[model samples]
Target: EKWAATRAKYPPTTLALQHFDAAYGIQLGHLWPSVRAALLCERKYGALVNNFSDDDVLSDLQDQGCRDFISDTDLEVHLEQISAVGVEGESSDLSTKTSDISHQQLSPLQISRNIKCLVFPRGDITRFKPAKPDKFGLLGYYLMDAASVLPCLALDVQEGHNVLDLCAAPGGKTLTLLQTQCLGFLCVNDSSISRTLRLKRVLHSYTPKPFLSGDNLRITSFDGTKWGEIERDTFDRVLVDVPCTTDRHSLVEDDNNIFSRSRTGERRRLPQLQLELLLAGIEATHPGGEILYSTCTLSQTQNQSVVEQAIHLAQENHSIHLQVVDLKPLTHMFRKTFHFAPNLHLGEMVIPHLAANFGPIYMCKLKRLT
Candidate 1:
């Protein structure tokens, strides 16, 4: 009864929404409404992990009536619109919204810039009429957010590089890395069994059986905070895509989300864990190797501050130095199709907005110097 009363007073979106406002108000003020509206809407724009399908997924989707978002002329013009631009030029009033955002015409940008993944124009996704029953049909594009590929792109995995995907759950980013055909051996790990099961299921459907059982890939259930100790100086590239207070899921999904009274305490501890996990990833990287730290939240505590503190602690505590790899060049190259927060020194973030509605994804890349 107390729980019921608490929920009645606060409502589902209350705590999460208030948390974001307090956490991100300085950075997202005035643009928060549209971001809220986009998150509330059900028909979210998502990407097809194209490389999963053997054939050209983009051309196949196009042939099936799905249009490429980046190539859409309307979206291109809307991107630069004076009023409609912000949140990476991604604002709109919730009061002025339709029942669903996808009801309005919006195109999905090739979130990966075709090199990584493709985004579906909002409404056209329902019109996807696949011609054949194969991997493409079995693998629907909407399984992942359009911007999920950002970290993999930033990681820049090279051929025969040893890689670690710490906290790899559901495995969408893992699939993206495979697209590069990089990795002498990929060590995929997630702490949670349920999430790891989902990751296994992803590999089962999208990946070949021979490959899953082969020497190239090994999935482990390990505490990500201890990964560095477990496998020190082991990887050529490491992707520490740590588990976070997933902003979109937190706001829209009240049940099983982090905002509840019982879970909020653990949520409060995320930054510290994030820092430790990042430091562990740093420890796991070979000297002269690269590591990409990422999160799906817009919180500075989770994103920038975590990266900042980890860089200092990794050096001070272990005598290991790391150099920041500038992500501005990547954001600029991807700007035409996606909306990114301007002037983030540590990394690039995809700002959630009405036009692209892709991400609240933030990533920073660092290279081990010592």
Candidate 2:
């Protein structure tokens, strides 16, 4: 009612409508009609489109005498309020101790450190689709969270390293590992048969022929919990991108959406399953090797608590030695664009941004001591 009343104060223009349509095209899932009507009633509707694409469209609007177009600079400044952009380390929450990586080994992956490249993954990812689809996906790069890509960097993959991506379906992180460093062999596994097929397709679509034909890649559908008993101490580096409550998929404006039905069930089963996967990754990693545990949720029960419980269980039950790899230094480097959530003793979090619209990822890097 308040928004509607405020919107009534202004009038909509044709250029504004066009720009709103473009934004709706980009975020097709979030087309709330009420919001659209409100945006139309007010002049505030069209500027959201400016954030997703370059200024060429705006230039065209200007040429058409659409003087009402929002400038990119203005959008960026507004976006900062609801975004993680420009946050400094000193201002971070003191409750969560930052992961300390100073004594840890440096990242083996060569990073571009370019803000442009880092921010590209956060944009309307469909823009990354290629004109021609090839095995290499030369133009169709897998779009994923930039923070999710950080786990591979945390692993510090070296040439000839043996790696495992447990629960590796839809192959985004798997692709990152392959792209970042040379590996002797990579074992990709997911428990679901259908998801495994999707992972295989992703691998086949992106990996080159030499890698596919070579004995270096193994794709499997196995119960991930049994991996610790099955492939204990096998991999030089391991990644556990465990399944969790993906909040993005759960968000719906309609009260009657079926998506909420399994929310309780998922929350109930997720933490233990997450711990099982993390422990399995730990068991599979060679002594002195590292494992990167990550999830796409903001739930503390699933993120920090799972890592803490797994660490305790591994020590008490299996008598295995594990160490949380400090990520403080790395987080410091990324503070400007991606400040982590506070009070995390086990990992780093990238909170979801309403404007930027990417991620709610949590990642913890761990090493097997013995």
Candidate 3:
């Protein structure tokens, strides 16, 4: 009644976001009230800083919630004002042709460390320089995906560790691993031929030539789940970023229609494949080595349940050496920004939020005890 009366009395543009609040209330349904409360108190924007120097300065900036290091002269201090509007009908001014949107010298706040990310006022970073070619390639300032970086943190790459990214595509986490640690060898593999090309482009665009051509690095196209059969207990550390239902994109819609899964049985298939890929990663990890299982979905069946099932199967097969690695140590960094699933003995979840809408990313770190 309040929303209709307000809308009828005045145009949506004239109202001070009460319409937006109501719209979200309708869309969020059961979750609206809590989300509204969170938003009412939440900071405007958040993002992680990328590729910075001077630890002291970074620390100071992080204290202020600054995330990005744009350039030496133009350190993005803060975002002053931002605006956007939805398009209902075609207008000549609104060209369909896509062009890059850039925001220079805007400050972002640091949210947490594991990957040294900052939070920002806006949820979507469409204007962020994602496609721009930097001179330093991987060494230069780059915005890493928060969800992608988390698994790399769970992997905890160290100097001279042999690593395998079993389903690496678009190479965000692969680049993070290379950037964070010195590695003996890094094998990045993806099953899809098309995605492998994109992965190569991302890597080639970001990475220095030496790292690209070095004997230590290898990029291949293959079925990731067959690694155990090909080379058992091979890598010191492995990252299995298996494909799963990308819930965020699918769960919500512009018309306020939500949770429209066309085929319910489809959900079970991905989890099965995820488990297979995870098991493959485990089998290919050296004794005493670590493996991180990750997916960009909130589904318990895909995330925690998959981890649980894998662990159970391993244990049933007399695999005491395979054990869950607790991630309690790094909880402080992400706790404020993300919701950790309760009683999460084997895995962690990065719940989606209105402030820093990154994920719905679930990760489980496992180690081979033997």
Candidate number with greatest TM-score:
1
Q: Can you tell me which runs of candidate 2 are displaced by over 4 Å?
A: 1-100, 103-105, 109-131, 134-140, 252-259
Off by over 4 Å in 1: 1-7, 49-56, 64-116, 121-142
Query: What is the C-alpha lDDT profile of model 3 across 231-321, one tens digit per residue?
Result: 7888999999998855443433223212223333554488888988988888888888888999876566777778777777666663735
Per-candidate Cα lDDT values, in order, are: 0.71, 0.60, 0.59
The lowest-lDDT stretch of 10 consecutive residues in candidate 1 is: 90-99
Ranking by TM-score: 1, 2, 3
What TM-score, computed on C-alpha atoms, does each candidate reach?
0.81, 0.67, 0.67
Clashing pairs in 1: 69-108, 85-89, 86-89, 86-90, 107-121, 108-121
Per-residue lDDT of model 1, residues 1-370, tens digit only: 6555544687556788888878677777777677777666653444554455565566766665545443344544543342232223212221122222221112112222443445555433352333232553435343577687777777876657888999898898887776565458998999999999999987766656666775989998989999877989878889999878898888877788888888878988999999999999999999989899999988878998899899889878999987776554455546766778775656779887766677889998887879
Residue-level lDDT of model 2, residues 1-370, one tens digit each, is: 6556543232223333443355434433343343344222311111111111222333443443323211112434333422332232233321222223342433342331111122322222222222234333432244455556666667777778998999898887777777643678989899999999997786666556567554988888999988988989889889899988564433422232223443446556878999998998889998988888988766667888898888888888888788776665555445444536655655887654433344557888877888
RMSD of each: 9.4, 12.1, 15.3
